[model samples]
Target: MTDQFLHDLLGRMTTDEKVAQLMQLATPFFKGASNSGEITGPMVNMNVTDETVENTGSVLGAWGAKEIKAIQERHLQENRLGIPLLMMADVIHGYRTIFPVPLAIGSSWDLELAEKSAQIAAKEAAVSGIHVTFAPMVDLVRDPRWGRVMESTGEDPYLNGAFARVQVEGFQGDDLKNNTDTLASCVKHFAAYGAAEGGRDYNTVNMSERDLREYYLPAYKAALEAGSEMVMTAFNTVDGIPATGNKTLMRDLLREEWGFDGVLISDWGAVKELIPHGVAANEKEAAEKAIKAGLDIEMMTTTYASHLKELIEEEKVDASLLDEAVLRVLELKQKLGLFENPYRGADEEREKEVIRCDEHRQTAQDLAAKSAVLLKNDNVLPLKKEQKIALIGPFAEGNDILGPWSFLGSTDDAITVKAGIEQKLNKEVIAAKGSDIETGEDDDLQKAIKLAGEAEVVVLALGEASEMSGEAGSRTNIQLPAPQLKLVEEIVKIGKPTVAVLFNGRPLDLHGVIDKTDAVLEAWFPGTEGGAAIADLLYGEVNPSGKLTMSFPDNVGQVPVYYNHFNTGRPKGAPDAQIRYVSQYLDSPNAPMFPFGYGLSYTTYAYDQFSLSRETLKKGETLTAQVNVSNTGKVAGEEIVQLYIQDKVGEIVRPLKELKGFEKIHLEPGETKTVQFTITEEQLRYHHADLSYTSDPGEFVVFVGPNSAEVEAQSFELE
Candidate 1:
């Protein structure tokens, strides 16, 4: 049946019946539908019961194969037109085989691997009958102060674009109709949500047209170009207009200019927020504005479903806009093959067979180990077999490995640090709670010290839970919550060789740990098999090669910092009489605790040299930039060969450096390998003021290294 069958059925229905299709209600994720207006309050309560999917208009963030299938079955069987509601979930990293966050994966600089992870997520999500995912958040994030930087691929347009294409392929695959397990990837917060004012969530985004076109639009374009079936408008505004209802943004840029023939879904309740932004008088007016602006779906907002039909019939809004919106929605269902095979994705056996399998666990472990950026390390790491280690912290024994938006994962099965260490060690290992997470009590500190006294080394496991740093989970001061810092400081006074293993979703201030601990490993809320992976790296089973995707600032005030920043005339370097007038801060060093692409390995590696195939090349000529990386350590390890490019004299001023390519290579002790990266004219262009992309004749520098901080530079010229 084409949408004509559904459309004709809808046509025969009463006004209330058509309105029901537009209405989207938020029900309890575990239960069904509810009359709850807003569930997220200060208490952080969740109202769940045994309710059917038909009571609510649509399901929001519901996972688990059994629950998801039941909801779908109910929607199809119970609804008046037998219309199946769209199932949405936040499959941010991985559905079951959890990979590192977008930022960490981006640090791998391996877009192929990133895409593969998404493919796995899509396969698992589709098994559960999920229609779409609010993912591949292609926000060009430059400010690390924003906790959600962990979710973005970092702050470069060209780099983000390349990664976006890979993610789209992973999510949508080649054929959506044939591949029901694959769902639509929603490239989110449509535009300029990353450049939030003051690094606050949902803050106003004020930027010039040139800035928006040049820096922010490329990744979203890349996703659409790669055949992303749908788009989710962002939560913030652009130039005083809310992105959910901005005609210039949604109509002009997304639909008309880009020729996107997909449905535009609004961020959660974003349509209803137009009133708060003073853009509309009420939800009714907001619906009128959003529908005209090209928003087809109103996620979690009742504005569209409740009022849009009334507005259309009364001539308050054109019925053609409604028709156009429904057409786009129907067309998407046709593309999904949902009309012909609505139950194609709802296979019970596939759901049980595919999710959280051994392959998924192994992949998760590999990604977790690879994402572990060795911030600071001494010989204390890769602990010897003879050593008796003390693992102490709130997170060590707890199975909280699943990060934010991981609704599908069960923490009950997550690997604990204690379990991981015991499996690898025959030596006596002492474990203690040490203290509470944020408030290290004096008695708890004494207990940690006592445990440290009995062990040869102390491995302090600390950091936030998965839910502490995601959306609406932002903190004012992103530091190691509470007494974990105090506990570590007291234990370090015992003078035992100490290593801090941090499990966090976002970067945290580790100044105290840096000052005290001999070694530190940022094991970002490594999902599910995190403990097993951490133990491998700790016991020398695997060498740490992961690099920092986001910078770790010394303090909250020193945030919005990154490695590829441009040089200012009065930067912190110059000796000045009055420092007050400069950009330098008085209280803290104007630098991050760890720079972007900053990581250390168990073994030492040296950069031999950088060489280019050609000094000058024609417009269409391909250039090869090569470098020799030698492992100069006793143990074998992996090295991430980073390649950065800079156009010295372009039509516009460029950043000091832009990451062009990277290769993660495995090398045995004393091994050397030559790595090469190819460059084209496309790699040498920037968006001009007139919104045109063109490459200029100029000198381009190719900097290669393990991370951004350390690199060997070579130059090439385009003729």
Candidate 2:
């Protein structure tokens, strides 16, 4: 549809209808219709009337084809303009067939798998009556203490931006108007939501504009460039002002500077919460400020619906802004083909077949295996299927493996570690529960130890419960629970080889488990097929290849350790440097437990130190760096060869090394593969003190190796 068509439709709407278009209510608001035509229950508390409900443009968190179709049918019958309701839901990793959390997917570093996961999620959601997904949360999180890090790809801006583009492409696809399996993607938590104070959820975020543009803003921009149709305001503030009402963030930067003309919505009552943030006195002021700040939709709040009319009537806000906001919503619906077919892809029959199908489960399993990071190994892995095994811990048979934001995913249907291992082997493996995620009696611990002693090997399934690390799940103490640690201590005393399979949402302090266990697999709450994936890794069916995206702290004291950090003037030269006056810790090491892009496979690879194509690169020319990587171990394996760069001198300080490029390649034993990378001038750009993104003419260092710490460097210059 053309712009004129949307304007014509908008011109026909009354003030109340136009205001209602900016208001998004939950599914229950429409369902709680009173016989006498008066709003009651939750809708009543929302300050909305039956008339307002009738004019509302969209529904939030609606599910099921039958229920959604019923609501839409009744809504179209009563609505005067015959505008269809847009259905939106939180379909993050997967809808019904759950995949590993976004952080795990980032560890895989496979763009094809990331896009495929989003495609499958969109397909399941579309069939189940969802028109839009509030997903692809691309915030770059450096602190594991920030619980929503599970929803993020990792801490690097370039990697996060790459995933953002591919995931957005997967969600919207090329033909959204005709493709029934696609969904309009809403890139969320705009500005700096991840840098919440104290690593707490919905806390205040304060950062310089230079830092925001240099680090936090790239992923959101990438998503917009990839065609994400909507943006969700974060629950936190940007520069001391709530994002929902901050004109500079929503208007001047997002609109005028970035050229984002898409619809902008709040993150669930964020408009009303501006009052609590002390930015507004009431919902009326919040409504006035939100619209003026260029927010198009107010989600699950009475601010827009209850107060927009008065704001427009009193001339507090321009009536033209209301029309433009309503027009944007109409344009989205038209692009979705909802103006013609209100029930765009809601089909109950297809929903049954596609929601949790075998094909989707298989893909999830494959990706889950790909996402499992091997944190520690002493050749104790790849257990024989016939070996007597004791599977012990809270998650041995528990199925709470699906991480947060998997609202549509079923926990009962999730496969447990014991179940997955049993499905593969002919004989049943004995299992015991040593401890719960938090606590257990000594008797249970003794029973588990005895079982481990009787078996030829022990596979300890440990880590946090699902609720421990997303959204409001921040933690100051990131180590495993004491009970689980005790279970490890007792089992390791049995003299049997132990392989710890950890299920978690964020990077953890693993001193207790890592030191005692013979091997450790960081199996982060691997979703529906998590158990199966771990079983595959343990039984040699698949080789573990995942690397860490976020750095695991040596302890909670080093809360926000990441590879891409600036060098201090008094930097500690080595892990055990004796320069007492330098920046050395009195009690702990400065390095993380595991560095970014660090993972161990059953096989090893040897790299011939990289060589540069040219000693100096001109502005318009590209420089290529190549290295020969050979598989040194007996078995074939996959390796993510990482390429990082260092700007020796900058107008502003730069990270010690920044990840610029990576290639995941598979090699057979003794097989050599030549991996090459090209460096462009754009890749060198960084925000200056004035926020101008340009590279200085100076010396640079190129680092190529397996991980951040174990790298070999070569010097180059940009002319």
Candidate 3:
């Protein structure tokens, strides 16, 4: 377990054994292998030998305590030196008790809740015998067309970085060595995987060095600073070369400049993908480039196992690179205490007691409630319990609310909207499966309309199916399916007070539901306790405190619209700009349908008396900006106070506003509170043309408001 012992172990490893350490195969490879080393089942074509299988350093997608225990026992018994297999899985959102998607967690804007949710996820996964989790994806996304946007927090680098820090803290608790409930968090897609072209998955990513550092890379840096044990290479090309084989990105910047000594892993089959990316011609070249580029592990690929030895023998790659990679892998295993106790936290009895207990489910429900954003609400919301209710749509009785990336969560255990409502009121509410996620028959529409006639209120549960968003779930049209919209139109004609509760993964265009529905709630893929949490919001048991982390477009045409955009030279509607020739769309507004930090509550708050401590801020000194906020409505509610900064004039063009910091506070009806934010010279520093991180001496403006669109501004000078 010591460093010396790891080095000694590495020194004894043969070329074949060392290469096997870099390969990560599916759980089935080990389970299906015979005692005679004959590769069987799906991977027979791979021609992998039994020795390689037995000496394999890690196993991917291995779940459940019983299965992992069996795999580890056999691996140690058959191996020459008995190195335990490192078990890993995609415990993205949850293991069994699911929580809302990462996008929704960003909407909550509550660091404590985000951290707690990750901690719960780690606890569940650790009990199931997983030693590492590929999570806290933290790729700052702006375009909604990318299906993986659901995995990220949102568009802003600052917000995503903040969440990344806490998620790492929660996953790798104060003491990873002693804490059985903790997991070794793997912050993924190392470089800018989120900036795929046209929001397409695995597309080429091209951006200037300044643009890349300024907008992306901050969250990954923050996660490393927070002590993540592993980093996964992206599947896309950074600059011109594939990230899996880009030596400048993986070695110069990450391993050398940043000093990230953690295990560098390749995204699924990414190392071999270099061949398809045109960087490498064959498997040997791919393995050489990936290893030389500092990739420690190749997930679901045979390039490392099949050709690493040949590349090392031909003198194309050094043997020291293999030693370094194997040592990193062994260090990780020792850190995980796999050498001392192979089954560190895997207990079949304790698994049942911890997986989806009441405490974990309560946290999931609470987070889902806070993560649900109130996008639009008329006086009709917070429905009266006594009012007759008719809940109808694809999601009425559908239980696919766990969202994508929830690989272990069971739909059978998911509670539906109908089940949630009846459990809350203790009586059956009339419900109808108006349509499937795509379309329905004419009789379905008539039946839903008739059901609306029986109730005083209609709650429409609709949105994209769990498949429409996540991983390969991108879409050109982000509106609700035509069938759901048609069902909405017919129900709206009936004239009952309507509320559209959307269960989706990405920020939707919301054309049909927004205008026709009297009220709208963005309940984005709420997990296992989704139905119950939504029921809580409908009956006023909980107030909505979530905000939009990503902007919702008016239409797909305004795909990348966000609040923190540049003021172009030919700005639209500027005082000095001309009319039609400006940078304005003829058919649509440049602003988003809903800006970042925009959310509504059952109650309201007003901001006034904004002031700054001084007009001039000197170096090595700080300034305090304060604003008096009052609850103007009757009910008590929680509000997120956002602080945005804009450099009036800089060396280069600056954005209209950039969110520097925010605070979420509670207030009683008619209660007033003075919220203050301390601004320092460091907060204004940005990557200049030469990538110098320093603030320019100039005029600056600070704004405080409920959301990004509406605010009260005050100006100051940095001297």
Give the per-residue Cα lDDT of candidate 1 at 40: 63
Provide the overall lDDT of each model, using Cα atoms, as 2-decimal numbers. Answer: 0.78, 0.91, 0.91
Query: Which candidate, 2 or 3, has the higher TM-score?
Result: 3
Q: Candidate 2's residue-wise lDDT over 1-719, tens digit each?
A: 67787778888989999998888988777853222234455556776787988999898888888778888889999999899999999999999999999999999999999899999999999988889999899999988888999999999999999999999999999988899899999998898899998889999898999999999999999999999999999999998899999999999999999998889999987999999999999889999999999999999888888788898889999998898888888989998999889998999998899988999999999999999999999989889877889999999998999998787888998989999999889568778889989989988888898898889999999999988999899999889999999899889998999999999999999988999999999999899999889999999889889999999999888877889988887789856556786776789999998999999999999999579999998888999989999999998899999999999999999999999999999999999999999998888989998888899888999999999889888888998
Candidates in descending TM-score order: 3, 2, 1
Where does candidate 1 have its weakest 10-residue lDDT segment?
A: 42-51
For all predicted structures, in order, the TM-scores are 0.91, 0.98, 0.98
Query: Which residue pairs collide in model 2, if any?
Result: none
Model 3 TM: 0.98
Our model 2 lands, by Cα RMSD against the true structure, at 2.0
Off by over 4 Å in 1: 1-19, 27-58, 78-80, 426-428, 571-583
**Candidate 1 lDDT over residue span 490-515, tens digit each:** 88889899999987767777777888
- Which 10-residue window of candidate 3 scores lowest in summed lDDT? 31-40
lDDT of 3 by residue, 555-575 (tens): 899988888889988989889
